[model samples]
Target: MNQKLNIAICSYRSATFGGGQGIFVFELSKALNHLGHHVDVISGPPYPKLENNIQLIKSPGLDLFSTFNFKERLKIFLGKKNKSSDDWYEFISALFGGFPELKTFGNRAKTLLDESSYDIVIDNQSLSYGMINIQKNLPLIEIIHHPITKDYQYDIQFSKGVIQKISKWRWFSFLKMQKKVSQNLKVISTPSHNSKNDIAKDFGVLEKNISVIPNGIDHASFTPILDIRRVPAQIITTASADVPLKGLDFTLYAVARLKEDFPQLKLVIIGASRPGGHTERLIKRLQIDQNILYRSNLTRHEIAVEYAKSNVAIVSSLYEGFGFPAGEAMSCAIPLIATDVASIPEITQSYAELIPAKNSNAIELAIRKIFASPETYQLRAEAGRTHIIQNFDWQKIAKLYEDLIYKTIDEFQC
Candidate 1:
């Protein structure tokens, strides 16, 4: 066993219900702690729900996105004592429609981390200038879960007009800082080969400097419930309906097309759709409102049960650094149909029925094939469960991280 080292993990925002980053931080910290390391998660607003043993150090910034009320934001911004320049910069930048949380969080994180003693600092995708400064002073390993440039590209591709494209560009303006900061980092980590390559291309980082350590799934929580009978013609997918990058719109279109053959077909989305949003309008336009259900704020057990009740799971992401929903579905032993996009293929291996992304016809055909041969698909689903248990389990993942951390510390000391 390696020497037990104190570790600090930094995240800009880590709301468990928020998105992939939050879940990653929460789960990874838990696994690291289970391996006998003393881990502390330092995060900004919308703090992560960590286990009792893990310490959480709050380093909040402006938290502009927390509320829409301008007056409330002003009060919080002005009323806070000993506010750093980073706080003012975050508020002012966000006030003008730029995402500055990464920079602000990085600035605050450097000061907080400098005061603490740790073997290594793990920056969980908060690619900011301050991270570069911290790396110069400490042993730092940055996780770049694919570059934000991909999101910007997808948004630009899906924009309705020139004005919307410009708006999208402005909202993602922080990519410039991320790209610049990433270049100087000594060591970087990513979840998949796809992400590693994308990061190299988009962030201009050397491929040799990046390490691939796949994320793990909690098999105990996501395993299949034997008592639940699978509902025929029911499909499950996790997505943010309003986000074009999630490809929920494509999934909705595919579900509409599938209804022509299987009229009893229903799609259950494990995510929320914004009221009066693009997804809401599309659901109305397709007339598939009656055939679909949206669910959110579900516990892991509840999500596993949802998987147990469904006949098929779909990952409709246009791109993913690592698809958590796909992994969760596989852990539950559900037949998965995922698009051959980004890291889905790398994660699912040969277990899933692959389809081309952004193509409704391909999605429809794949679903029809699965329904036609339920027994075969069921066997494949079981294989998926086995694959996850054998390869993507948290214990195995944590060991890999442990090895990497030890190796990094050794090389740094020499």
Candidate 2:
């Protein structure tokens, strides 16, 4: 057996409710721990829900996004002691719409980590300036799930006016720090080749500096529950947030188009849609309000059961660093219809009914075809399930990371 190593996974703001980063940290830590290694997840607010064996070092931040009430947030911000003076920067940056969590959390994590020892550290998409210093002491690998430039492009394209475009740019201004910090790092990793390529091009990092390590699917938890009767015309899809990036708007449009033909349809979304947001308004406008159900903060087993209950699943993402929902749905033995964009095709390995992105008509047609041919869909579902179980074992992924860790440490010592 290889020597057991200590690891720290840094996530500035883990998605405790409905996002991918938290799940990545939880699964990675659990898998590494299972490999006879000690793993600690160092995070800011909204931390991940890891298993009991894993340690969570809570490095709390201002959590500026916790509320919209200005006065309440102001009090919290004012009360924070100016230890490193990044608190002021966090306050001002967030005041003008810029996100400072990455920079602030990195400062806190650096101090906390300096008081301890770790063989290596993995920054989970928080490409903050502080990480460069952390790597100076301990071998560090930064994970940029994908370049934020893609999001910026979408923002510029979707903005309604000059003011909106400027506001969007301000919110994402942190990308400057990300790009600068990423360039100084010796190693970087991403979940898919699509992301690897984008990170190289956008962050100006050489392609040689990036490693592609696909995320592991916990197929053991997301197994087929044969006892649960599949509900007819019951559809399952995941849109973790109401952002345009997830392409929920297209999915909603497809559901609206399918409503007339499939009146019995019930689209169960695995995440929440913002109240009074575009999604809610669109649901009302399309008059398909009655057909949608939202289920969030579900455990892995719970999500699996939901997948098993569904007759079909959909992944209508415009882009994904990795399509976790697509793989998870397949793991549950559910037939999937996903957009062939970014890493969706690569991640699913063409085990899905692939369609072009941003086309509601294609999504509608794909769903119709799946329902039209049950025997064929069933075969595809089983094949997808088999592929996920064989390919995305977390244990195998941990071993890959272990090899990378060994090589990095060897280079650091030399």
Candidate 3:
């Protein structure tokens, strides 16, 4: 048996239900600890909930996202007993419509790393200058799930107008820092080959230096519930509704079309929509408001139950690095329909019903076909479950990570 290593995982922010990155930090830390390693997660605001054994060292930031009102923020800035440079930078940048969380969080994380000792540092896509600074002090392995450049491209492509395009560009300006930091890292790990290719192209990193380690499904939490009754015509998808890249608008259009034939159809979104936001407006414009339901802040068990109850699950993203929703739905034995975008095909393989992205007609047709032949689709769904259990178990993924960590350490020493 290899000696257990002292590992530190750093993230700008982590929340159990926040998004993929947070879930990645939480799950990976737990998995590493389960493998007999001592894992410490260093994170900023929206701290991740970890298991008892795993230690969490809170590296607090301005937590500007938590302060919803401008008045509250103003009060903090005006009354200065004493404040860190990071606090002021975060408040100012965000007030001016720039994302400074990664930069500020990285500075704080670097300070923490300087005072702490770890055999290796695993950065969860902070992709900031501080990551580069930390590399000079300790061997660092970055987990770049996918390039933020793709996200910028998608946002720019889908912007509503010229003003929106400029805003999106300004907000994603951190991509410049990320690209520079990514290029200097000694080792980079990605969740899929598609991500590896995207990172190489978008960040200008050599493909040879990027390693592929697919994310795992928590089978224990995401498994099929035999006793739960499936809701007829219930469709489920997980995405941040306001983000255009998520392709929820296309899914909404498809559901509106499907209601003409299947009036009972219900689309359940496992995410929140801002009041008067684009998604909310689209829902009203399509007049499918009554048929759609948004459920946010769900526990893992609740998410699994949503998957088990649904007739079919959808991954409508224009692109995904790993497509966790698709994997989780498959783990719950639900038939999946996903767009053939980025890494969706890689994750779903032939198990899911593949459709062209940004095409509501294709999505509608896929849903109709699945409904027409329930028996056949159910078998395919079962095959997907088997696939996830065999290939995407977290234990298997952790072992892969363990080997990667050891290899990275050995190479750094030499």
Candidate 4:
């Protein structure tokens, strides 16, 4: 064990209930804290809910855009107090970038780093130039959840029209800045080998400069609920339906094709589609509305219950830097049917049934094949649970991170 040290973890979002990044920062910090280390999570709009004893440093964004309405908006504004120079810069970037809400994050980053003091500053994909300023004050380590370029390439390949392509291009314009930051920063960490290769190839960073730390799961929070019994033939997938990289729309397509043979086949999507949104329209067009279910705004507990009830869980992503859903489902002892996409195969390590992504026939066939062999589900489910526990559990991940952080700190001293 190492001496306890003051640490700061920063990210654009902190509401662990929302995305994987939030969940990562929240749980990882908590796990570190539990190990008798001092952890302070500095985050932006949609702030994280840390444990009562833990320190939560809120770096609020303007939140110019959100899925919520007036009352929720009021709460966000009313909750914020401090602002910083990075906030102003991020604001300018977002304004010019055409996504007004993004300005809030840019600004928050500037604000948080402008007056930084910590033993180590671990940035959770808040790859703003503001971080460069923090590096000037103390050792800074970045956790690139995955390379953003994969998402960009996936978008360019699957986009429907010129306008969509252009919009995605603008959204990803920040990656250039991120890549530059990575080159300058000495210490970096990513979740999986898939990400390690992508970072090296796309960002031009050396493999030695980056550390590999698997994403951790909270066995207590995500443990199975006794009542969530295995439904005879049910499947669950997570992510925004509009994103082609998620490849969930293809999963739904496979479901529609399989429904004729297995009328009771149910595909539960743990995310919603926008009206006139890519996913909603796809579902409407495919005419599988009756067999599919959509859920969003679920707490980790609720999601675990949903996972516990399903016969199998699927990761329909075309690319994953590190597959959180796949890992989480495996933690819950659910049989996984994941695609042979970026980094996913690395995480699953042949413990899962892998299929090629974007192929509806293959996805449908895999799902049906699993249905045909009920005995394999329990065996695979048990194997996945054991695998995740041994490898990706938070305690093990935290220890690895602790080693990397101290190593980076020592090197900086030299």
Candidate 5:
């Protein structure tokens, strides 16, 4: 048996419900722990929900985003008289439209981690300068889920106004630091070949230095719950509103147009929308507001229940390092339709129906096809569950990670 390693996984802010990054940290730590390694997830707020066996080290920093009101945020800046200089730096940077979490997280986490010795450290996408300093003491591996260059380009291309465009430019300036820090790292891990290629090109890293490891699915939590009766002509998708990368705008158009064919058709979104945001306005404009339902802050079991009740699933993402929703939906034996973009196709094209990106007609047409041939699509859906089980089992992925950790350690020693 190989010697078990003590690993610390770093994530700046891990919202357990909102995004994939938090779930990635939570699930990866759990999987690694199942293989006998000790895992400590070092994260800032909104913290990840981890199992009892795994340790959660609260990452110390000024978590500006969590303070919902501006008054409380102002207190964070004014209240701490003895605060470190980095606190002011973090707040001021964020005030100027820059994302300072990762940079600040590295500064705070390095000192916290140095108190304890670990054989290896796994950074979940915060390739900040402080990580470079921490790597001097321990072997480090970066899991760049995908390059942020895609997000940056998308934001610039889809800016709503001149002021918004300028704000976005400042917000993503951290990409420069990420690019600089990534180039010198000896080993890196990414979810797919598409992401690996993008990282290499954008960050100027060598292809050989990066490993392509697929994200795993928990079969137990996401299996098909056939006991639940499926709803008629209902569709499900996971997307955030007003985010061009998520392509929620196109999804709304599809759902609105879809109502003409199936007047009783329903659509459930597994994400939150700001009450007065662009999505709300779009819903009103389309006059199909009654046809849509929004569900957020759901547990894994609850999400599976929603999947079991739905007739089909659509993924309208313009880009994804790994399309978790598609995999989770397929695991639950619901037929999937995802855009043919980036790593979505890399993992899902085998089992899912691929459609051209940003096309509402494609989404509407695919939904029609699935409903048209229920018997054939049902067979495909069941087959999808098997495919997810065989290809993306957690244990198999854990073993790969275990091997990678050992390899990183060996190379570090040499």
Candidate 6:
């Protein structure tokens, strides 16, 4: 093994079961440490709670509007009292997009890079110009999980009306910054080939400069178990809270149609329902509100158990750069039916049954077809399992990252 290299990973949020960024940072650092590298995770609010061995450098955000428990801290700083979490969220939500703390994070990252000699600075989607302009001459490697442009496009198109659609177009501002910063980075890696192509097209970077490294899941933790919570005829999916791009409407419509044929059909959503949002309204209109189970704050093992218990797993995203839910479901050996969009087909090539992304009828038909035959479910699940184990084992993928780090270090030295 090569001598250990100190790796600095900067992410906007911690993977505290809230979203993918924290998960990516934590898992990547764990894998790097497992490979005998020193990994320092620097993050803003909603930080990852990693093991004791790994070093965590907190880059506290101004978070003017505290999202969760930061209201007290905000009060202490400003000499105020009795501010609620929602008030902080509303305040922060207004300014977080253009907040200067994010820029400060870049300065802090630069300081860490300068003082702590690292072989490489691995940025996990913190595409600020400060990171781009860091003084450290060390190789800077950026990991764009997927292009934000893809998310913006899907979200805009999913809007119910023209006004809402135009409103979403403003979120594309991140793309401009992402493009400018991405072009200067020497080695850029993404989660999937679909993402690689997206980066090439959207950011105007050459395909060769962008490498493909799929995200990994813990094989031991996500393994199949004897599931006791089996609802005889139920389907499960993980959706982003109030995000139209997730295709929750499509899944709800599909389940509504399937429920007529299979009345016992239930759509168990592994995400919290936003108050008075489209997801909640759709469930009400479909008259299947009673059949839906929406919950948040699930552990990895808990999610795996849900996968094991479900008759089938569905991913109804309008587009996925790389579908984490689909991969995790497959890791648990559940038959998958994901939207035939962006990278879903790439990961689930012949391993899954895919349907047109925005077609509710297609999703419904796929569900009916799978449940109609028990053997089909078994075959698809087995194939998905084989595919994931062969392609996405974290232990194997971690080595690629190790080799890439060494190669980047050598090139930087030369």
Q: How accurate locally, in lDDT, is each candidate? A: 0.89, 0.87, 0.89, 0.78, 0.89, 0.77
Q: Give the alpha carbon lDDT tens digit for every residue of 1-414 in model 5.
A: 299889999998888898898888888999999999999999987798999999999976778877657788888778767788778888888777789998999888888878778999999999988899888888999989998999998888888999999999999999999999999788899999999999999999999999989999887899889799989978899987677798888878988988988888889999998889888999999998888989999999999999999999999999999989989999999999999999987777578899999899898889889999978888888898898899888889989988999999998898
Q: What would you estimate as the lDDT of candidate 6?
A: 0.77
lDDT of 5: 0.89
The per-prediction tally of clashing pairs is 0, 0, 0, 5, 0, 5
Deviation in Å, model 1, residue 387 alpha carbon: 0.5
lDDT string, candidate 2, 1-414, tens digits:
279998999999887656888888988999999999989999998878898988899986888788767897798887777545777888788888889999999888899888778999989988998898898898998888899888888878877799989999999998999999999998888889999988888889999889988899989899999899989899999986557777888888988989898998999999977888778998999999999999987888999989988988999888888878999999998999999999988878768899998899998998899889978988988998899888889999988888888888888788
| TM-score per candidate | 0.97, 0.97, 0.97, 0.91, 0.97, 0.90
> What's the residue-level lDDT of 246 in candidate 4?
89
Per-residue lDDT of candidate 4, residues 1-414 (tens digit)? 278888888877766556687788778888889888888887776777787777887765666446345566556554646645544544455444444333345456556656755788888886666677777778889889887888889888888799878877887887877788788778889988888888989999988898888888777667667675678678898977687788887788888888888788888888766778878888888888888888888888889988987987889898888878988888888778899878898778877889988888888877877888968876877787788788888888888889998898888888
Ranking by lDDT: 1, 3, 5, 2, 4, 6
Candidate 6 regions exceeding 4 Å error are: 64-93, 96-104, 160-167, 227-229
Model 2: per-residue Cα lDDT at residue 394: 92
* Candidate 1 global lDDT: 0.89
Considering summed lDDT, which 10 consecutive residues are worst modelled in model 5? 60-69
Q: Which of candidates 1 and 5 reaches a greater lDDT?
A: 1
Residue 39 of model 3: what lDDT? 97
lDDT of 1 at 237: 92
Off by over 4 Å in 2: 81-84
List candidate 4 stretches off by more than 4 Å. Answer: 67-116
Candidate 5 TM-score versus the reference: 0.97
Per-residue accuracy of model 6 over 1-414 as CA lDDT, tens digit each: 389888888886674776687777878899898888888888876678786788888864544534434656455445534544433543454443433344456655676566677767888877777677662477778888787887887777667797776566544555677788788777888888889998899888888888898888776677778636567888999998788778888888888878887888878899888788888887899899878998688988888888778888899988777778888888888778888888888888887888888899988888788778968677778777778888888878889988888888887777
List RMSD in Å for every model shown: 1.4, 1.4, 1.3, 3.0, 1.3, 3.9
Task: Give per-residue lDDT, candidate 1, residue 232.
Answer: 77
Quote the lDDT for 285 in model 4. Answer: 89
